[model samples]
Target: MANDDLIYKTATEISALFRKRKLSPVEYMAAVIARSEAAQKKINAFTFTHYDEAMDLAKQAEAKFMKRDGRVGVLEGLPIAVKDESWIAGKPTSYGSLTVGKGYVPDRTSPNNERILKAGAIVHARTATPEFSCASYTHSRLWGVTRNPWNRRYTPGGSSGGSGAALAAGMAPLATGSDIGGSIRIPAGASGVVGYKPPYGRNPDDPPFNLDPYCHTGPMARSIQDAILLQNVMCGPSPHDIASLRPKLRLPTEYKPIKGWKIAYSFDLGIYDVDAEVVANMKKALRVFKNLGATVEEVDLGWTRDAIDTGMRHLEHLFGTQLALTAKKHSKIMTTYARNFARKGAKSKASDFFKSMEGAVRMYDTFGPMLEKYDVFICPTNAAPAVKADFDENKDVVRINGKVSPLPKVLAWCMTTPFNTLSRCPVLAVPTGHASNDVPTSIQIIGRTYSDADVFRAGIAYETAIGGWYGSRKARPVL
Candidate 1:
């Protein structure tokens, strides 16, 4: 195997090797750092890296193994990476925009970061995100576009774009990602990595909105098992987050295929004009689930394109609001998309915002009954293949199979975002196969609300049968 090939071990595999003295965390850290340095020059995937700090953590991890008494925490010597949006004390939080420049260094940190550190995971770098994470794709005047790893000519997907790129490029085995609207799943599918977006509050955030909220901090990893392992560490009810689930539950110790789990599959959620090849790959994946003893069936989410469109107009203000908070001072240097997104957010009337929130409630109310009939919902992770590098997330119009689709911007053809808006379900995006066009594709496995582990368990079964989805191409610069 080539040196790059040897660098692809998952966190669990690395920990075992570390415990046996076959590999040192320091060696693993250096290997990943070297990969990150090479890929960073091309992809700009990171906002910051702590090479010295990472080595120091590795030395501590190495010493723990030297004592050799028990298994380390779930993260144990893993070289974890954090998104720039999540606050890390002493480290600058940029929210992917240049407006903040360097004024704020958080004295207080997010509980999510604290939880990971308590588990012994070493967070050695901060990944880039879209400006205020306003748009779906990761492009900002401050950090530039984060290119895809498979065919650098394409986007790795966004918000979590840097996390996705870093993982696919072998920069890290696992990283932290937050998804409000497919930020986790889109990039996971785009980059052919497995990303898990757990139920809201599975990993708690800091105060303010913590009283009761919908946002989640989840795990993005190279495979389903890796995603599961990291989430296992990160999950638990928080004193700060009232929305957090009560009475912590243990991670299912066994992930064996459930003998008969009912899975509902949809190509377009009933009304989406998905690419034909995307439909075919989704079908291929459902068949794999069938072979694994799952009862796969056709199901509809009861949402027409019109309904979703109506909801989006009102719902988008939530994200646009952040841009307005940072836009004026940074407007001159902001990407056009960021500026527009902020202005639109600031202009949204309360009537439109509430109307959208109400529309979202209607969707969720109808979705709950459907879940009673199924163990999970399976769908195409995205409506299309990885978009070309120049594909603009803000202004680009997407055509599906030559038909001009109505879905707006980067949000079009997405199956993962609806879950974010409805039922607060957890979804895992796992690679299915490659298309003839050299773009990678994926299948989404969504579990019932709060059954985050189930989604990953199913993903592990699918991945094991398919031998996991790594692109055939080696890492190279897109530009």
Candidate 2:
């Protein structure tokens, strides 16, 4: 196979080739590492790398495959880019902040990292993120900016922006992403890749974030099968996390077709001011579901901006509060957005937090019943194509469909937070098409509470109908 083919091959394809002795793990790893280095010069996606060590691991995997050993794990020879936010023992996990990450190293690995390592996947690089993983676009004082591989002027979306960019640039076939509020899906949509936000507890997470129902650690890849491949390995109960669900759920590689399935869609989710290009792409994507024999209908969520406000309040109370504590000592060195987030969090009251909880209950009261009526819900993952690569949420103005919006209102353009408010629902983000600027747009496939398989069933069907993404040199990012 050509080097570009080796670099961009899906994890599923790479794994099969490794098993069949048609491709050497070392050869594929080398191509990917080279691609990563080249892409980094343009997209600034990786924070650190372990190329030599990764090469050594690839050799071991090749040896195992040659020996026809039964010891091979599901992801035996794949190269995965781990989000910098995840902890790996003895490695520097800079959450893209100098104040918190300078010279910091954890003695223990995060559950996500431990599981990925045990699955025999090689981690060749650590992708960048916003400070404390707090922003929607990836950029930081520590690692500079991570741009979209498709269009450098725009962001790849965040806080898993780097992972999405890496996958889109063919740096790696798969990567890991954590979502408290659309971190994985935003980047997946902007970068034209696939991302899955499993229902909370379907995948094990490190504590205290694990205890937060809105937080989820999942997979990002160039294809739906690749996302499912990594998710199956990352999920299941772990002794390390009490919140993990009992009796693991393993998804099948293939699902029964979506023929005759009922799919409900929302262009704006009732509050967001969606861009015309995004809506146009969403309409085209809906046609894919229709072509697959699924019935599509538009629904009124009856939701208001309160859904966005509630999710922000909850995050400020929890995620942002932690940032506030960190800023107590490191405020001088933090990014403006991070500091602003911390300040907002510090001002939140117990009453505010409780009200946010009550608001979530009200929001779910409607969403929960809607799921019962439809096989899955579909909406644009992001209301706009993307923010600027160096967008400052605190100072920059965001214009959606020609209407100007402010800092918090900027959240109004992302249709993801509402689902995070209904934290038990599973969401899968898949690419639709590119905007005029060449930045990609995507749609979300939402399932009923804990109905993980349903979203994947819809996603696989949609992906198949679209003939899959990033399949050729022309389909991938020019970088």
Candidate 3:
């Protein structure tokens, strides 16, 4: 491994270094602190960067690693940045929301981070997110907005924006992110990093199934291998999440090559107003898959507008009631747009909500059999090329094909969300190529239910073929 470990230095490389005693876990932890502090001032990627606690944990990991014990886990010395929404003990886990940041402290910690802690990794910092993770671009009244590392004038993509930016800026070795409607993958694309939105129940949730339909907590990293390493530590079923599968869970391995694998590419998955640069970059990247001997076809996934409506109504039943009480009391603090958006969802009747759920059930069932013939599905991870610095996700303004479009329609460019509806399928977001503006455009490669390793395997092939993400190490110096 190189001394300046900036590129796609996977967990495998780090592990080998640790095993050889070439790198101490504490040294990695120090790097995490310095890099996180540096990335924070430039990108606003973290809500809190824990220095003392991280080193304390790293020392323990160093001792454990030096013992030459076979029991040391795969992620023994790894440092991970967790999203603020997913709690870490004693940290200010404000979900980047005005209410929570004001003083909505919790007495308990998130079971997800707790599981990672038990696996021997350290929580180096807590990344930023949208207020309550409401939008696709990450901006919050509490922590302000996070800028992309490629260009500070643009957004890093949101909800999981901080996680994406932190990883992209080399703030931490890896980070945790929760996706509800493309939160993880969207930012992953914008920041030119790897994001995996696991099938629902893949990783146990702390609060269980709060807004279960589109919510998924998964791993995000700088490369396919790091993502797999973090996923290995965090994945497996748990009783905590009633939706989770049993403890025997593991990343499915595929020794098969990428040659001749059938990949279906849906430009919009039926309908979306996307940027020309994004589309062009994606199409160009498709040729790489073709060169790798994969049969890439522009196949439609046959999605109807009801997919969005169905997903939203599901949100209404879940978040509507929960946020209504909060909204009703603090409606003044909430954005007029956000309050109205949540309020509209809050008004859904039981009948409509049930019908939406039923329709989604039928939709997924109808969609499942079609995937039996294909190894994976592909699509752009976001609507536009990359959002501007002040881009308002709450607003309905979106330009597609030189015409103004609605936010819901263009945001539909995210072919990544519906798979989360499938519960056990795995979706890996890999940077395809940089847009005309130099920010990266990414595609989501989704595998069948519980086939996460297949997604990682495909990502590995793509990473090897395309080489690493460009300009990944250039960032403002925090010092």
Candidate 4:
């Protein structure tokens, strides 16, 4: 296979090759490292690289495969890009901020990272994120802007922007991402990659935030199956996390067909002013489902902007409060967006937090029943194609369908926050098609609460119908 082909190969295919001795782990790792270095120059996706250490680990995996032993971990030789926010023992967990991350080192790896490491996936590099991961786009004082590989002028999306960009750029076959307000799906949509946001406790998370139902640590990859591969390792019960679910649910590599399924779609989710291109792509994607023998229909969620407001309030109460505390001592060093987010969070009252919880209960009253009727819900991931690579959420304005709006109304263009409010729904983000600028447009496949298998089954069918993304040299980003 060509070097480019090798670079874009899926994690499952790479693992199969390693087991058959058709490709050496070290060789694959070296190629991935080279691609990562090249992509880094173009997109600035990584915070830190461990090429040397990764090669050492890759050698060990190669040795294990050479021995033909059955002791190899499922992810034995694949290079996985870890988000900067995740902790690795004795390694810096930056959270994309220079304030608290400057000289800090953690003694224990996060549960998700520990599982990935145990599964034998090589952590070749740490992907970048917004300061404290407080924004929707990935640009910060610590790490520069992470651009979309398809179109560098646009953002890859955030706060898991780096992981999404890396997968799109073929920097790694798999990567880790944490979503607390659309972080994973935002980037996944913008970067045209597959991202899975498992139900809140489906995957283990570190303390404090793990307790926050809106928070989720999931998988991002070039393909749905590859996303599942990493997710299988990252999920399950963890002794350290009380929120981790019991009786682990492991998804099968293959899923039953989605034919005869009922799919419901919404263009704007009743609040967003979606771009024409996004709607066009969404319609085309729905046709794919229709062609597969699934019945597609439009639905009115009866959801209003209040859903977005409540989500922001909840995030401010939990995630933003943490940042507000950090900003008390390090305001000058924090990113403008992060500081602004902290300010809003600081102003939140206990009543506002309680109202947010009340709002969630109300929103779910409509959504929970809607899922009972439809096998899954589909909608545009973001109302617009994407913001600029260096988008400043504090001051920047987003234009969707030629209607410009300020930062306060920005969530009107982002449709993922409602799912975060629901918290238990499983969401899978998949590309629809690229817009005129070449930045990708995507849709979310949302399943019933904790029905993780439903979303994957739909995603697999949709992906197979679309022939899988980034499978050929021409399909990959030119960068």
Candidate 5:
């Protein structure tokens, strides 16, 4: 197979070839490394590449296969990209911040990442993020701008921007992403890839964040099946994370047909202003669901502007408060965006946080019943196609449908965060179509809280009806 062919192949396809001995692990590693180098040059997607260690691991995997060892794990020999925000033992973890992370390298590994390594997956690179993973765009003082593979002028979205770009550019077959205020799905929608933010506790995470429902660590890939492939290994209970669900749920690789199922879709979730291209693509996607023998209906969420405010407040209380404290101590070294985000967070009151919790309850009061009637809810992952790579959250105003939106709430441009407020629900963001701006648009499949399987079932059904993002090399980023 040609190098590009191997690079673009899904994990399932690659594993099949590996089992058949048609593609050796060493060969696959070389192909991925070459593709990653080319992609990095074009998009600046990775902060660090582990080519030397990856090559050694690939050779060992090949030897095991040659000996016909039955000890292979589910993700045996697949190249996976680790997000820099997650800890990898003995590797420098900057968390995209020079202040808190003074070249710090942890001795312990994050639970989900440890699972990835144990699954026989090769970590070929560490993807970039905004400083402190604090913004919707992926440029930082530590690493340069991370651009979309589809259009160099636009951003890939953050803080999982690098992961999304790498997957689109075929830098890796699978990668990890964390969602808090739409970090995972925003990039997924922007870069035209598959990203799943599993229900809180579905996947084990390290400390304090594991207790925060709005934060999730999940999988990103080129196909739904590949996302499931990685999720199966990354999920389950961990001794370190008490919040992790017990009697762990392992999602099925094969999904039941969505024929005769009822689906609810909303373009703007009844509040935020959305671009016309996003609306058009969502309409087309709804048609595909109807063509697949499913009933698609539009629902009114009646979610007010308060929903956006509440979500932002929750972020402020969680990450923003601490970020502000860090800025106070190291304002000189912190990124301007980080310092500004901290300043905004510092202004909120303790009582205001209660209002945020009230907002989540109100959102669920409406959605919980709607979900009971419908098997799944569908919506645009992002309101706009994507912002510029260098767009500043502090200074930029997002325009949707030719109307300028409120500034400094750049996270508002994405529709993915309200679901973060309803964090127990499983959300899957997949490419819908490309906009006139040349960035890909996406639709999210939302299942009832903790009903993770329903979303994937719906996702695969749609994926089968209209092939996946990898369906056409023409549709893929030219880079």
Candidate 6:
């Protein structure tokens, strides 16, 4: 196989080849490390790497296959990139902030990362994120900018931007991503990969975040199957995360046809100014669903700018203030947006937090009823293909439909926050199409609360219909 073919193979493909001895795990790991090094020079996706340690793991994985024992895990021998925000035993987890945790290391592993390690996957690199995973674009005072592989001038989307960019650039076949406000899906949409934001507790998380329904840790991959492969390992009940769902859900590799299913699509979720390119691609995606035997209809979500306000305020209450207070001492080193978020969070009152909860109730009041009527909901993942690689979250204006909106509503660029408010719904961000700017765009396939399987079913059907973006070399990124 050509070198590009090796680098671009999905985890599923790699696993299959390993089983057949067509590709050795050691050989694949070397290719991955080499490709990752090259991609890093271009996009700055990974922050930390342990290629030497990863090679040893690959050798052990290769031995398992050589023994022909039935001891292999589903993801055995695949190279995976872990997001910098996740803890990995003794490794330093920056969480994308330079002000704190510069070289701080965790003695214990995060539940999700532990599961990935147990699945026999090789963790070769750690991807970048915005400081404290705060922004929608992936650039930070610590790790600089993580550019889109398709267009270096644009961002790959964040706080899972590094994971998304690494996958698109073939730095790794599978990676991890966390989504509070579209961190996973935003980068998936921007980088043209696949990101799955499973319903809260569907995939076990670590810490206070595990209890916060809006926060979740999930899978990012080049293909939906590879994503499923990783997600299965990462999900389940954990003693550390009391909120994890019981009777651990394991999705099947095969999905029932989506024929005769009803799908409701919203261009703007009732409010934000959407770009024509994003709308055009979403319309095309809807057509693909129609072609695949599902009925697509347009619906009004009745959402308002308050959704953005509520989300930001709630996040401020949860993580913003904590980060802000910490950055206050190191104010000189913090990014402008991080500092602003801190100030807003610091000044936010209890009433503001209560009102944000009210927004969640208000959203579910309408969305809960809408789900009963439609099998799933679809919408653009990001309003625009991407912000500039160095886009400033606080000062930049994202012009939509030829008009600039208010500064506070900037989160509106990503139509993902409202769903985070609804928390239990499973959202899968899949590639819809690419924009003229060459950056990729996507639509969110949202299922009823906790109906994780349904979103995957819809995603697989759509991905199959669209020929899976990374299936063709010409379709892959030039970098």
TM-score of each: 0.93, 0.98, 0.91, 0.98, 0.98, 0.98
Root-mean-square deviation of every model: 2.5, 1.0, 2.8, 1.1, 1.1, 1.2
* Residue 227 in candidate 4, Cα distance off native in Å: 0.9
- Badly placed stretches (over 4 Å) of model 1 are 207-214, 310-314, 393-395, 471-479
Name the better of 2 and 4 by lDDT. 2
Off by over 4 Å in 4: 406-412
- Model 2 lDDT on a 0 to 1 scale: 0.90
Q: Say which candidate scores most in lDDT.
A: 2
1-479 in candidate 5: lDDT tens per residue?
56776788889999988888888999999999998988799999998788999999999888777775567878889999988988988988788887745378899999999999999999999998998788888998878789999999999999899999999999999999999888999999999999999998999998888888888999999999999999899899999999899878989988778889999989888787899999999999999999988999999987888888889888888788879888888888887788887887788788878999999999899999999999999999999999899988667778888988763356867888898999999999999999987899999999998999999999998888887767556766888
For candidate 2, report its TM-score: 0.98
TM-score, predicted candidate 4 vs. hidden true structure: 0.98
Taken over the whole model, the C-alpha lDDT of each candidate is 0.76, 0.90, 0.73, 0.89, 0.89, 0.88
- lDDT (Cα, tens digit) per residue for candidate 2, span 1-479: 68887787789988999899999999999999988888899999999899999999999999999984467989997899999988999988888998966578889999888989999999999999999888889999999999999999999999999999999999999999999989999999999999999998999998889999999999999999998899999999999999999899999989999999999998988787888999999999888889889899999988887888899889999988999999999999999989998999899888989989999998988888987899999999998999899998666788998888543843645778888888889999999999999999999999999999999999888888878987878898897
Per-residue lDDT of model 3, residues 364-415, tens digit only: 6656775787788788887665666556645646666688764363244455
lDDT tens digits by residue: candidate 1, 140-235: 777777888777777778779899888888888888888767888888888778887777766776554453234567889886777777877777
* Model 4 per-residue lDDT tens digits across residues 377-474: 99999888889988876567888767785335435457899999988999999999999999999999999989999999999999999898987777
> Candidate 5 has which clashing residue pairs, if any?
none
Ranking by lDDT: 2, 4, 5, 6, 1, 3
Model 5: residues with Cα > 4 Å off, grouped in runs: 100-102
Clashing pairs in 2: none
Model 4 per-residue lDDT at 60: 94
Worst 10 residues of 5 by lDDT: 404-413
Better of 5 and 6 by lDDT: 5
What's the TM for model 1? 0.93
For model 6, what is the alpha-carbon lDDT of residue 2? 82
Q: Name the candidate, 1 or 4, with the larger lDDT value.
A: 4
